[model samples]
Target: MARQDTIDVRELSVHYHGHLALKNINFSVDKGQLIGVIGPNGAGKSTLIKAILGLERSKGEVSLFGSSVKAFRKQISYVPQRNMIDWDFPVRVKDAVLMGRYAHIPWYRLRSSKKDRRKAEEALDKVGMIEFADRQIGELSGGQQQRVFIARALAQDADVFFLDEPFVGIDIKSEEIIVRLLHQLRDSGKTIFVVHHDLSKVEKYFDHLILLNQELIGAGAVKEIYTPEFLKKAYQGSAAVLDDKDGMVVVSQ
Candidate 1:
């Protein structure tokens, strides 16, 4: 039997002030796959994700789990870039994570239930941030903050996860933790999409890849998409491919 598509995007396009950011992009992700969205700077990687999430004005069709994006919005979790978040938000780590449960609870209910608090605590513990639950988000290091954000997303208990530059400015340990969690999530039959910049770790980190350059360059298994040709096309010849004993390493010039 064929695998079901967890995410489907067709003819996706995005424009900002008449400037084409993404054009007629198309891709589909199957269940239990970790997909890396890669491209050069300003190559529409973020735009594509935003369009698929319906967070930006775009022209295309985006479906999640065979349902329209709007209908399945709550089933998806997004972790934006760490730099995009205000460091001085004055929110505690647990409180920040508890925000994820707002969708499941009605606004008329003033307080979260015991189940919600347990879920938030579990998420924090999974990310090794339980001890810092009461700490102010602004007081944490960049890597710690990133982990908290990821915990928040995990607390949502969404089937689909989208992360943008999650490893940026993060410590090696944090990156390792996040990658391990991603693999664990994938093993549990969840679909994960990460907007990543480091080309060197793409092969080791992701099973699938979506190459973008204001359009769809390629989308498939890592072995097929992480080739010299696709790298050159996406990075405009600024990428140099080196073959190693394990696989390939792409270094940007």
Candidate 2:
């Protein structure tokens, strides 16, 4: 059987104070791929994610798993950038991870049951942060903190994931672990969308690519979308894609 589209967006547009932030963007994502949403600074990479998720005001149609976003929100998991979060929230690592289960809890309940705690611990283990479960989130390294966030997402057990710059300010080990877990999630049939900036690791991290610059430039396999022609269009002559032995790398002018 053919794979179904986990994310289907049509003519999605977002504007700010009469300024067009995104224009008639359209794309459909299949299940089980690590898709990189890439573009230059202020290219609306994060805006597109927010628009699709309905966090930002926009005009268009967005459906996840054949259902409207409102009906399927529980099936979606989002992890915003580290800078957007407060590290000094004074929350324990395990407690933070357990927050993912909040939606799963009954509306009448105020606290998590034993199963929720177990799932949270299991998620922490997956990110190799179980040992730091009792530690304050602010005390961990940048990478460790990022891992803890991913663990929280894992506990949600959602079919679709939106990660905004999870690799930023993270260490090599944390990136490696996160990427490995992402691949495993793909293997298990979950679609993951990551807003990434570094061009060097695009191919290494994501097989699928969505090149955006206030609009859709191209969306397809990395080999098809990650080229000089597309990069030029997306960056508007500000970035130069160079030939690298590993693949292609981008250098800003």
Candidate 3:
């Protein structure tokens, strides 16, 4: 039997003012795959994600789990880049996470139910942040904050996860922990898409890749799409692909 597609994008395009950011992009991700979306700055990697999520004005057909994006919006979880969040928001860690449950609650309901709180606690425990649930989000370190956001997504219990630059500025320990958790999610049959910048860890971190440079360069398994030629094309011949002792490729631009 064939695997079911978790995300499908066809003829996706985005425009910022009069400038075209992404043009005619298309890709599909199957269930249980960890997908990396890589490109240089201004390559529209983030734009593509926003377009798929219907967070930006775009022309395309984006479907999640065989349904339209609007129809299944609550089933998807998105973790934006850290810079996009205001650290001084003055919200508690647990409260920040419980925000994920708002979609499940009716608008007439003014508070989260006990079941929602239980789910939030479980998510916090999974990220090892349960002890700090009462602390202010602004008081945590960068890595801890990122983990809290991850827990927020976890609380949503989403089938598809989209994270933008998740590892950027975090410590090695936190990065490792996040990667491990992501793998666990994939193993549990969730589809994960990350906007990643580091190419050195591509082979080790992701099973599939979407190489983008305002257009689709390549999209497939790491062994097939992560070639030196594709890297050069995606980075406009500025990327240096080096082979490590372990036979994995390390890319520098």
Could you report the Cα RMSD, in angstroms, for every candidate shown? 2.0, 2.2, 2.1
In order of appearance, the predictions have TM-scores of 0.95, 0.95, 0.95
Quantify all predictions' global Cα lDDT against the true fold.
0.89, 0.91, 0.89
What lDDT is reached at residue 87 by model 3?
Answer: 87
Cα lDDT of model 1 by residue, 1-253, tens digit: 1124767888989989989999999887888899999999889888888888899999988878778878877888999998898878889999999998877889799999999999999999999999999999999888899999999999999999999999999898888999999999999998999999889898899999999999899999998999988888889866787777886667785
The reply for model 1, stretches above 4 Å from the true place, is 1-4, 243-247
What local lDDT does model 2 show for residue 85?
A: 88
Q: Point to the candidate with the largest lDDT.
A: 2
Which residue pairs in model 2 clash with each other?
A: none
Ranked by lDDT, the better of candidates 2 and 3 is 2
Residue pairs with clashing backbones, model 3: none
